[model samples]
Target: MRDYVQTAEEAARRAGHVLRAWSSKFTVREKSRSNLVTEADEAAQAAIHDFIHGRYPHHGFCGEEGLSVAGNDSTYRWVIDPLDGTTNYVHGFPYYSVSIGLECRGEMIVGAIFDPIHDEMFLAVRGEGATLNRRPLRCSAINQLDQALVIASLPVNTDRHDEAVRRFLSVLPVAQAVQRTGSAALNLANIAAGRVDGFWSTSLKPWDMAAGILLVEEAGGRISKIDGSAFQLEVPNLLASNGLALHEQLVAALV
Candidate 1:
């Protein structure tokens, strides 16, 4: 697990450097109606793929940039989002990051998320706790939904947009405040670091929340589907919060 963590951190950092270098000059294309992808995303994923595959040739890889490498080992897989928040990155928002999560036998074992612009690295290993820049991290202790700061993201080009909007409306009057940061990965990292009290999102890909989910879990947070089901990597909608009294409140409001 330590080796996996180290390798993931290194890969995330190297990919961060690539993203930072291309931040000033990169071409963007629409991946969907409003979602964007840039040249930096592809390049960074390539760098990460090369680095990780070089280190562990027998491990599989699933990257956002369509870089999938199937190796001899079927039990270990690296999930990569070389440049999460591509929209923010293209617009120079500085809120994007490089996210990597390693799963062994279908269980997330290690995770790393690097915010290049701020040089913040959030990492975790299952059962070993989480960290931000080598400092221990824990979720906020806020136990009331009315006083909790929360974040959420709406699905792109989905018929459920109306339902999502209603859910946000449901949370708005009760929570201290609500925001959409354009990066689910960063939002989860923030929740893990105690910077945000809660986060919920729908229509997310595996790469978007894989690393951040582990960060939250190891930081003493709770995660589940919007309907209160167990969260699986393949499930798109999720609600994560500090594992305090407010979790049930959040689920109640969102559901």
Candidate 2:
């Protein structure tokens, strides 16, 4: 493994440890009417920050707990979500995870996501394909829209409910099923592992989707802005799919 990837894996695992430790013993605070954050999130971010900064002193970081430093002269940047699925975690749902990604020169290069509850780790490096616990992963081969299981995320705390509902309805006729998993990190991880056919969500932070995007691509899936444009951290909209043809059709229908 590349040094950065190795370091990321270590950081992710350590963050997972922090997450597990605080899983049920933490207090939740409302960040918004529909959003929550827990002590686990902050603790996990602190551990990741410590681990990564110890090895790569100058690398930039943008973490979910609001950890950011001065941009580095180097091209590398770390995007982290110390705890994803916070609401789920607080409610005793076991779907939360720690996501970490390294982007170099505007391209996502390494990604790792650890689901501490399940002890599952998904990892990918640019051009190296994706894996879960060292086993290679491939996206599903399903091509027909009606045979696909899709995930759609609606912005709960925003006024996008009607628009989100309209979009979901438009795609519902063509999809076999649709779900809202509440965790972009897990959504992308499942896409990479072929457990789900595709995922679409608006209103995400860079830390939430960065790692999972690289994982999906490396697992032979396609990812893009909802309008089919290339995705970037600033413009956080994303649509990841196993079947390109179906993805295009869905995008066309929504637009």
Candidate 3:
């Protein structure tokens, strides 16, 4: 497990290098309305895939940049978001990251998220405590919503009538503070590191939450769907919090 975690970290760092090398030099392309992609994203994923696939040739690969390969006789699959905050990266906001998570038999077993700008590396293995920059990580102790600082993820082009917006408004006056950060991966990592109390999003892809989900759990936080159902990677919605009474409180507020 530690070996896999090491590999994940190496791959994430390698991708981070690629992203930094391409900063401000890559061409941007819109994936959809208000959704952006750039050459840096593709370059970073390619770097990650090449390094990981070269080391573990039989492992399956799924990346945010439309790269997919299934292992023929292996249970290991790496889900990657080489660039999690593309708009931030494109705009030189410096909040983006490279995320890599390993799944075995449909369960997340290893996770790594690396922030190039800050050089912060978050890593976790199943049943093993999580770490940030090699230091142990644990969620914040705030259990009450009224005392918590939280974040939300609203899909690009979200409007006033959207359920996401409605949920955002509902939580704004309840929590100590509510913020909308473009990067879901970092939001989850912050929850794990106890930098934030909780976070939820109804719109995410598997790669977006894969690594960060494990980090939250390993760091002694709680994770589930917004409705408090079991978490599914295939499902887009998620609620992650420092598990005291905060999980239940967030569930009620989000749903």
Candidate 4:
């Protein structure tokens, strides 16, 4: 366990360094209509995979770059996103990160997110709470919606967008401010560090939110479906908040 976290963090930090070096020389390509992938993302992911494979040769790997083993053999799997904000990185935006999380038997036990630009590391181990660069972090105290700063991972175009937009519009009048940070890992990290009061999104992959979700919970926040139900891997829609008095109301509005 100790070794896993160490290797993952080391790999993430190394990826961060690579990111900083490549930020100035990035070559971008479109993976889909509005989605993108970059050479930097590939390089960072390769570094992480190589580091983990060198140590744990048989462990399974699943990552954003599509380098994954089909079957789970060692009861542990690494979920990774070498560059969580490729769009921002291509545009020279500074808010990107390397996110790595460990899942044992389908349960997330450890997570680490590194932002090379800022040198901030968010780490979480199940049952051990969470931290940013080794300093313990926690959620905010803003209990009411009117005083809270909320965030969302906006979906571009889907049937769900209308419903999500409605929820966002409803909450906009109540929240002090709303911002989209582009990275789910950092969004959750911000919640854990009390930089934001709450976050919700309708669509995300397992690698995107797995580690960050644990960090939020360990930091004293409450997370559930936009409808106030418990979280599940299959249900990407979520509402995570600093444990507060108006949680139920917020969930009701979104869910």
lDDT of each: 0.91, 0.87, 0.93, 0.85
Please report how far candidate 4 places residue 136 from its true position, in Å: 0.6
Candidate 1's clash total is: 0
Runs with alpha carbons beyond 4 Å of true place in candidate 4: 158-161
Task: Order the candidate numbers by TM-score, best to worst.
Answer: 3, 1, 2, 4
The residue-by-residue lDDT of candidate 1 on 1-255, one tens digit each, is 778899999999999999988878998788788878888999999999899899999999998988777879999999999988888888778798999999999989999999999999999999999999999999999999989999988877646448888898899999999998889899999999999999998778999999999999999999999877899898888899998988889989988
TM-score of each: 0.97, 0.96, 0.98, 0.95
| lDDT, residue 187, candidate 1 | 94
> Tens-digit lDDT track for model 2 on 35-78?
89989899999999999998888888888777887566468889
Candidate number with greatest TM-score: 3
Indicate which candidate wins on lDDT: 3
Instruction: Tell me which of candidates 2 and 4 scores higher on TM-score.
Output: 2
Report the Cα RMSD per candidate: 1.3, 1.4, 0.8, 1.7
Task: List, residue by residue over 1-255, the lDDT tens digit for candidate 3.
Answer: 877998999999999999999996899889998799998999899999999888899999889989889977469899999999999898999799999999999999999999999999999999988999999999999989999999999988988899999999999999999998789999999999999999999899999999999999999999989888899999998999998898898889888
For model 3, what is the alpha-carbon lDDT of residue 41? 92
- The pairs that clash in candidate 4 are 226-255, 227-255
lDDT of 4 by residue, 1-255 (tens): 778788878989988988888888888888776688988999999998888888888788889888877543669888889999888888888898899998898888898999888899999888889999999999998878888888878775545458777777888887888788889899999999999999999888877888788889889988888888888865778888887875786886675
Between 2 and 3, whose TM-score is larger? Answer: 3
